[model samples]
Target: MMKLDFDDWNIHVGAPHPFNARAVPKIDNGTERPDPRRYHDPDFMREEWDKVFARSWLLAGPASDIPEAGDFFTFTIGPESFIVVRGEDGVIRAHYNVCPHRGSRLVTADFGSMDRFTCPFHSWKFDLEGRNLAVTDEETFRPEVLCHGHDLTSVRCEVAVGLVFICMDTDVAPLSQWLAPILPQLELYDIDKMYVVQHRRSDWGANWKGGVDAFAETYHLHAVHPQTQGLMDDRTQIDLWPGGLSRQFVPFAQPASRYPDQETVNPGIQSMLSDAGVDPNEYRGTAAEARHTVQQAKRRRSDELGLGYDRFSDSQLSDSVVYSLFPNVQIGCHPEAIFLHRFLPHADDPNQFTYDTCILYRHVDAPGYRAPAWMGLAEGTDMSGGTRPEVVHTPLGAPPGLGEVLDQDSDLLPIVQAGARSRGFRGPLWSEQEGRLRHFHAELDRRMTAP
Candidate 1:
């Protein structure tokens, strides 16, 4: 039997708050768009980078990425390169990946295990604890220069529900305070125990917010994502929290017809299904049996995480949950696997953003569970060097490549970027269904305008 923290889990309801809260400046949907100036002006972007990005809690990484002492991973947070390292003492910490001496970058590689960070420029050495231990010229430099206070600048970092988050602000409230309401639900993923199986990166000509907004709603799935339209229908629903976090539920079931021959075995679902250890044979026969078997398997996994024991009781489990942790990180939790996408801004222009996709699932069983068709659909090929991955280009005509069908929703981004600047285009048609978007922009506006 798997042991888990049951008290940390709770029911996930997509209901609006019952009581009225603090007053937020409301946007007028009747006339004028959200200022186009906000997207293009360097001053505006800088202000946001300082007020919004600087003082907020951004998802940095998960503990699983650095399971053992001395393990570390490097990433970018608002033009700043951050390194999350598990020290020799088994404590995980975040630091600005810059050398204090001559301002050289420390640790240029993506990730690895190291006892100390040595600056390539001047050979300045520091331990995994981030302390300035050795200096090149001991005679010339005063003792104060080697003091602990003069060591690497550290950021406030914390782990909750298996997800790692870092704050640039030193005086920010405890992460648990800001993430309390949703922490219980997030614990269901057992993310702390998960590891990254793949990492992908690409650049796009769109705003960072646009990249985030892309995954905010599924109302466009049918029309925008035609290939997977049937996979994600209207029954899907989304629930949003105050801190730029949201959970989307979409129903999915094991298809009996898809793997007819493998009646006694589970069809390969890449790393995802294999991790859950679903019995391939048990999920055969009628649609009811397939659904029942899949649900039972999910219950087994959830039970291991100490979450949602009653979730499988529902017959039609038609929803997949997509969780977005403010500003940039989005987690697509499919039953078979987990996908993470992060949007990083490259320039002052909100029209340009970097898109990264990382998929993590258990490796397929060794003597082998391989299904060509199933694998093809799950693993998107690398066509980055050729045409853009997936973008909606109506006026540009259909995608001329053959990797994967680029849909409208993906294409709609550049248009929104262009429209945001046009006198004709302004604010969006903000609705209750688009509550997450509304909440996101509202919090952004508040932070950007804070004194």
Candidate 2:
């Protein structure tokens, strides 16, 4: 009962989709091969820190992480660390994690609640607003030394669409303006109403950009994650926007075109149907109908539970609308929840980076309401915002403890990094599906080569 043509599987160009209706001009980043050195050269990495990381608005963490006054979390990028805290006045602010005197790092814990930040090294104290409270035997110091402000140096911090972003360069555009290209689309999810259900950070044996390139597209999914072929369509519709923003709309609950038997309702499709409150035994349609079936079932379930699915389009309900934010963040948007992935660079090693993952869920009280099974949240995850979970840190080469798809990525990226280092290899020749990678590198190249 559904069209099986692979070429026609994607959303029609200039179609009437909700996200596409916005006035995002499509950008055609030329087909230039990216330099391999950008991934592993230490000099290139240093330049990226100066040009891109320092000048751009980087996603720090969820605003939901600090819901109350004095609640704070630490986010480290390259050689610097920042303390993002909600002040008593209900304003969220970020300050350098280092103490002004003698440069000892403050707030070693990942997250906590405190009226004042006390430096463990010398007992120097600072208020939640980053105002220096105590000087630790200040009378011994000269007036000129003390005259210099002891207050913690503040970083430009702003919140948009429920995420906190910090910019080291004070002169850069405001967060709203920088994200103007995709902000409206992001707002439709009501991300501020969601809460972090799972958080994990692990060191990976790849450059931060390597991780970014891996996630920018799904061209490798059929080859690397064959298990997903049964449930996810690899023929993704790529949309490129300005400011290095791009998204791929991949239909779910349907078999990939490469699958030999597209007529059968496979196990993956059955599981998705069950998650959507549909009985697989009663699903009398072919595999292509599975996506629509789940979408309608989810709609019915939402209406019965007052879950408010009217605002979302049918594609948004049953497809993986994954967005790749420039530099190092990728977001997977859905009605029930959202996935946030951050690839953070290592301070000293060009061959290593940290992969941070957070799963945010919009809480609903109905017994039948739940996140899609494809989200792969761990068993016993706390959906309620009752208690925030501590971040789980996994060492390099150890199991990331993320889902199966991500674990496969973790294992494969290092090999890709190693391959990039080989003398025989020249550079990556991207295909049409890899437009996001080209767009991202173009932005990076633009920054690196700027006057």
Candidate 3:
């Protein structure tokens, strides 16, 4: 299923590519101690708002979330808000969440469907295409004021590999230009057809950068989520890219170096095999063989089973090639499903942030079939069984807060935040393996300080 190159790509199936590139400057922002104020200073947070959050392109949600005309969802980050909507003509667009009339917030709920958005305060209406349809008191207001081009202030929106992204600022480069080097890598797993099966949002006690930092490197993996030791080799291999985007390749379905016996199948491998819809007992090979076995099985049966996993390579199927988009999105590109995380800053506090998690799987109606084991869903579970998928929200630091692995992170991040301000505490000294962290902060520093 893996092509030697992307030459034979059918845009409908594979992402067409000449793989345009944005140059990544050789820079290291990680050699020095990360300023502790980045986690808690109000002034630093303001700088981030004006420079980073306001200008960068952000992942609103999947295009599949609003599959029908007039369906829409609201994505709010920091103080900015936008609505990603599917138009009557089937085009996906994003509009600012403010009414042009009185500046009252237009869309209240997280998601809904409508022919037009009627301002609750003054009843000024706008169509799904963001056209200013009707004014409450048309006769009183002069035509000069009403026709002054106050259509729902459209935000810059673009779609790639199925995600709807919005840019708050008006002057940044196009999304494609920003996504240059990272786009082709993401194209490996066809994302346009995938549907979100699990959506979980949780507010964390740490800063947004802290949340992003935790997932960027695996150096903390053996310490924070010790139970996950053998699930994969967590010694992270950081792959730097242009525009602060990078990836960490962690070998999956294989035991970590610390595991006692690499010859036999570890408990982690057995659990993974069972979760992947493969019977570990039925596997007649060693633990090293389990990963390839699942990869080959998934590739061979993808079309027959209706799960479109044939696009991924054996390495992609078993290992975690987590592609991190600049600023706040972390995309875990897997063979069967894609794991995503969006870290949002708090409206007022730099010390607090929210972590939004979504797991998207290839949608199929086949019975007795299972998606990737990462979601902890029952083996052979049909996520498409329901009319629509439901997003489950849970408070962090609670039982079943996005499952066990995340629960550990949830508990630890808050403590890390508390320690950040300790009188004796010094700044963090990252190891070479966490060079991705240095690369990210380097880009962030450039962006924040750039004119």
Candidate 4:
């Protein structure tokens, strides 16, 4: 085992490594020079999926998702199918889904439970702990040969905020060291205490990066999310971490037209408003109706956690932080839930990508509630044929259903894919606000070119 340390963070490995490389200095400023061809290059994508996607900290199904022993779920990363199961010992383990004896996939379905898993191909039996039990023709096989190094190769699995994360590389670091800067903030949301409220997946025609990059910044909120503009003030502050990740903080929004004085507004909303650059004197000077509305929205958000996004400022909620973790995974935090979005390459075509969105909330209200009706999937922009809605967040207007928002976002992907390769269009121009996206590319370049 080789332990790698990056600053105060620990990359947990068994023993210490001989040497180390500190992360390259942060990019303070640079002109936007994004290459569009990277989004359409098959060679580029293949390498990306191999080097980045395979080894990275990927979200496994939620812990609550497989609360009982023998519970299991199948998920894919890069070209490998991985299975997560809870052992009889009550410990969760993740292993490559392929059978150790043959290449047959171990678990085919989404998620279920059993005391043992029998490979349908050759009837190879494995216990829930991933230990090989018996083979069909055991007498014919040499016992020494049979016992020689046969066991399900387990990957490193850990839990944080109730979300299960697996790393294909056994030498990779622990989740805590990698997630140091934001761990405190994440715990504040008590993600581990939450369970799945709903989950959905969509396939985007554009490159994986296109779909994920779209969610990195709120700079587009004003133009792309007109409905949410009034609720979200453009002046929300963005705080970037040393590692290139960042969080957008939106203090609560109180429309001047609604509130008459700062005293009338809820204390929480008033604090949020002040954080957003509103002066107490100015808040007091606001109209009576506006003040009343601000107070009302504040109470609604406080009481419901995050359900009333339409009523409160998107930035006001402390749990509303999102992280653009280096390459493919994006974690969006809400008071009541945690959503994970992963962009996976479909094939050699960089324009084609597999998008998986998983929303996990807690089972606080009910111990054993079925997944939301929206779980399997709504309509997406693909061969799937089902039509999901595009949800819009508006300040003054009504918010669309979640399905509608997902649908709208899915439709734009293919168009972007086409434009990336079109003769008329040029490459994307990354902006200063897109530090994470830029940092992502810089890291990609660094890893690809590393010795």
- Which candidate wins on lDDT? 2
Where model 2 places Cα greater than 4 Å from the true spot, the runs are 1-15, 21-24
User: Would you estimate the TM-scores of all the predictions?
Assistant: 0.73, 0.96, 0.88, 0.72
- Positional deviation of residue 354's Cα in model 3 after best superposition, in angstroms: 1.0
Ranking by TM-score: 2, 3, 1, 4
Q: Which stretches of candidate 3 lie over 4 Å from their true place?
A: 1-30, 142-149, 275-277, 302-311, 365-368, 378-382, 395-400
TM-score of 1: 0.73
Model 4 scores a C-alpha lDDT of 0.59
lDDT of 1 at 224: 57
Between the candidate structures 1 and 2, which one is better when assessed by lDDT? 2
Taking the tens digit of each residue's C-alpha lDDT, what string does model 3 give over 1-451?
8735321210111123122121246344546776777778899999988999888999999888899999999898898788889999999999999998889899978779998999999999999888888888789988898777778999889998899999878899999888887787787677777787777788888899888889888778778888777667765445576788886767778766676656687777887777566778887787666777766766656767755565455566667778888899999987557888999999989888888888777655555355665656534444672444556666645554577888788888889999987866676787676777787787888888898
Candidate 3: lDDT of 105?
A: 90
Between candidates 2 and 4, which one is better according to TM-score? 2
RMSD of 2: 3.4
Error (Å) of candidate 1 at residue 29 is 12
Residue pairs clashing in model 3 are none
**Every candidate's lDDT:** 0.59, 0.87, 0.77, 0.59
- Which residue runs of candidate 1 sit more than 4 Å off their true CA positions? 1-33, 142-149, 253-318, 362-412
